[model samples]
Target: MLLIVVLCAFVVFLLVVGVASFLRSRRDDSDERIRSRLGALAASDADVETVEYLVRRQMSEVPWFNTMLQQMRWAANLSRLVSMAKAPGTPGLYLLLSLTLGLLTGYAVFLLSKMLIAAAVLAGIVGYIPIWWLKRRCTKRMDRFQEQLPEALDLLARALKAGHTFGGGMRMVADEFDEPIGSEFGKTIDEINYGMDSDRALDNLLNRVDCPDLKFFVVSVNIQRETGGNLAEIVGNIARLVRERFKLHGKIKVLSAEGRISALILTLLPFAVAGVLFLLNREYMSLLWTTELGRSMAIGAACSMTLGIVIIRRMIKIKV
Candidate 1:
C-alpha cells in the first residue's frame, strides 16, 4: 500500500509538471499582455520601449522556462546571473558549475534508485533543486528591498522640503535610512556624481527595480525637467501612492495567507511522514526505496506532490 501511494504520487507529479509547463508556454504567446499593463501608467516611450525590448530579449533567451518563471519570481535570479558573469564569475564558469552539479547529483540519485526510470527522474530533480532554491531566495530578498522603497522616497521628500538639493536629499536618505533600499539608491547617487548622466543612473535604478511605480517615478522626473513644477511635491505624491499600493497588497496577501499555509503544509506532510518512517523502520521503508516496485512508487509520489503544489499555488495566487 505504501509503495502504491508513492508510485501514484510520482506519476501525478510528472503530469502536473507537464501541464504547468504547457500552460506557461501558451501564456507566453502574448508578450503584449505584460506590455499592455505597463502602458496604462504614465511612462516615457523610451522607458516602455526599453522594457519591452528586455522582456522580449529575455523571453527569447530562456524560451522554455521564462514564462513559467513569471510566477516563480526569478528576475533577481536572472539579474544575479548577469552580475556574477560580469564580475567575479564567468558565464562559461557558471554554466560549467551548473552542469557539474547536475551531473553529480543526477548520477548519485540514479545509483540509489532500484529502477532506471526513477533514478533518472530523481537525479534531474535533485540537480536543479539547488538552483531553484537560490532563485527563490534572491527573489524574496529583492521583494523585501522593494517594499522599503516608499519609506526611502518619503525621507527624500522630507529632505527636499527642508531646502536640500535633490542630490543632497538622496545622500541624506542614503545616510539615515536602512540598508537594501539605502544601499541601492546611494549607489545610484554615487554613480551620478561620478560623472554618469543622471538619466542613465536613474535608468539603471529602474532596471534594478522593474516595478511599475518606480517606472512612473522616472517618467515623472523626465517630464518635470521640461515643464518645471514643484519637484518635491511630485515626489511626495509618488511616495504616498507607493504606500497605498503596498498597503493594499498587504491586505490581499493577508487574505490569502490561510490558503497558502494550508497548501504548504499539505505539500510537505507526505515527505515529512516518509522521512519519519525511514528513520523509525528502515527495513519496512527499505523495500519501497530499494526495490523495483519501490522506485515506481517513488516516481508516482513525486508526480502527485508536484501536481498538488501547482494546484495549491494557483489557487492562492491573487493578483492585485
Candidate 2:
C-alpha cells in the first residue's frame, strides 16, 4: 500500500512538473515575441538606452544547475544535436523530459513484473527515446535539404548567368526555393547584409547544414573567387554532379532494400516468438524470468542479438 501511494505521488509530481514546463515555455515564447516588437520600435525611435536595457533583460537568467549542465561536454554536444535537428526546447528541458520518462517507465515495469533488472533495462531504453526522436527528425530534415540542393544550385547558376552578383543570386535562391533550403539561404543572405564576410557566412551555413553536396558548392565558390573562372559554369557542373550522386544513392537504397527488410525481420523474430509463447503458456515462458540460468541465457542472447544487428547494419549501409 505504501509503495502504491508513493508511486501515485511520484506520478503526480512528474505531471505537475511537465505541465509547468509546458506553460512556462509557451509564456516565454509570447513574451519574446512582444519584446522583439518593442525592441524594433525602440530601435527606430533611436532609444539606445531602451534597446540596451531590453537586450540585457532578454538574456535568460540561468540558474546554477543549468549553468553547470551547460558547462558539461555532453550537454554541449546535445545542444549542437538539438540545433542540427531544429528541435524547439533547451537542453535542460530535454534532459528533464528524458529523466521523467525513464523513471515513470521503470516504475511502471517494476510494478508489473517485480523485476529490478528488467525494470532497469526498460528504463534505459526509454531514456534514449528523446535522442532517437531527435535523430529521426534531423535525418529527415537533412534528406529534404539534400533533395532540394541540386535545384537550388541550378537556380543560383541561372541567376548568375542573368548578371546578378553572387549575393544577389543567393537572394534569388532564398526567394525562389521552398522552406529549409530557402530559410537557410535567407539566413546566409541576412548574415551577409549584416556585414559578415561572405566566406564566414558560407562557413556558418555549412556548420548548420550537414549536407556533403553543399561542400562542393562552397568549395567551388571559394576557389572561383580566388582564381579566375566562370562562376555560372562551375555552379552548373556542381548541380549536375549532385544530381548524379543523388541518383546513385537512390539505386543503392533500392539494391539494399531486401537486406534491410531481412535484418528487421531477424531482429524482431525472437521477441515475437517469446511473446507468443508467453501468451500460450505462462508457466513455461516464466522460467526465462524466474530462474537464474534462464536469466543468464537471456542476457547472453540479448547481447549476441545486439552484436548481430550492428554487424548486419554495417554490412548493408552504403555511402554514396
Candidate 3:
C-alpha cells in the first residue's frame, strides 16, 4: 500500500514533467526557459555584516509562494543549499514535495498499521528524503571543492609568479579547474568584470562555498589588498598548509575508520535482530509493543540507542 502511494506520487511527478515539456516544446527554443531559472541561482542574503548584500534571487517562481518563503529563515537556507549543490528545483517546490510525500506515506502507514507512532516516524523520514538527498549532494560537492582547493591555489600562485595579474590568475583558475571551484571562481570573475569590487566578489565566493581552506585564501587576498605584500608567496604558503592539513585529516579519518564501522554495526544490530525475531516468531517479538512494560522497555532502548549514536559520532569526529 505504501509502495502504491509512492508509485502514484512518482507517476504524478512524471505527468507534471511531461506537461511542462510539452508546453516547452511549442517554443522555438527552450533555452530561454532554462536560462530564466539559471539566472535566479546562487543569491546572497542581505543579513550578512560585512556587506549590505542584495537579495539577488527569489526562492520560488510562484509569487505567493515566493512571498511566503521570503518570511522564512530556513527557506533561504534551503535556497543556499540548492545553490551550492547546483541542484534543480526551488526550495518551495522541494518543501511542497516533502509535505505531499509525508502526508501520503503517513496516511498509508496509519491505515495499514493503525499505529500513530509508526505513522509519524515513517512520515518524518519520508518527508526528509528530498533534504537528505540534497545535503548528500551538497556534501559531495563541498568535498570535491576542498580536494581541488590546494591545486587551484597552487595554479593561481604559479600564474602570479609568471607575472600574470591577480585577475588574470583568477581567470586562469576559473578556466582550468572543474566545478565547483571552476564555477565559483568564474562567478567571482564575472562579478569583478561587472564592476563589483574584488573584495566583495571574493567574499561572495566564500559565502557560496563552505570550505575552510578557501577562507584562508580569501582573507589573505583581502589583507594583501590592504597592506602591500608578496601575494603570490602568501598563496603558495596557504596551498602548502592546506595540503598538510588534508594529509593530517586523511590520517585521522583512517585511524577512526574502525570506530565508525563499529558505530554503524552497533546502530543497525538492534534493528536487524528485531527484524529477524519478528520474522521467526511474530507473536514473541510483538510483545515489545503489545504490553505497557514492553512499551516502556522499547522506549528505554530507543533512548539508549540515540544516546549511544550521539556519543559515538562525537568520539569519531575529530575536527582539524
Best by TM-score: 2
Instruction: Give all candidate RMSDs, comma-separated.
Output: 12.4, 4.6, 5.7
Off by over 4 Å in 2: 1-15, 27-65
Give per-candidate clash totals.
17, 0, 0
CA lDDT for candidate 1: 0.64
Please give the lDDT score for candidate 3.
0.80
TM-score of 3: 0.83
Q: How do the residues 269-304 of candidate 1 rate in per-residue lDDT, one tens digit apiece? A: 987998999999999988886777876787788888
Which of the two, 1 or 3, has more TM-score? 3
Q: Please give the ranking of all candidate structures by lDDT, highest first, separated by commas.
A: 2, 3, 1
* 1 or 2, greater by TM-score: 2
Worst 10 residues of 1 by lDDT: 84-93
Q: Give the CA lDDT, 0 to 100, for residue 217 in model 1.
A: 75
In candidate 3, stretches whose alpha carbon ends up further than 4 angstroms from where it belongs are 1-56
lDDT of 3 by residue, 157-274 (tens): 9999999999999999999999889878887787676556788888888889999989999999999999989999999999999999999999999999999999999999999999
What Cα-based lDDT does every candidate model obtain?
0.64, 0.80, 0.80
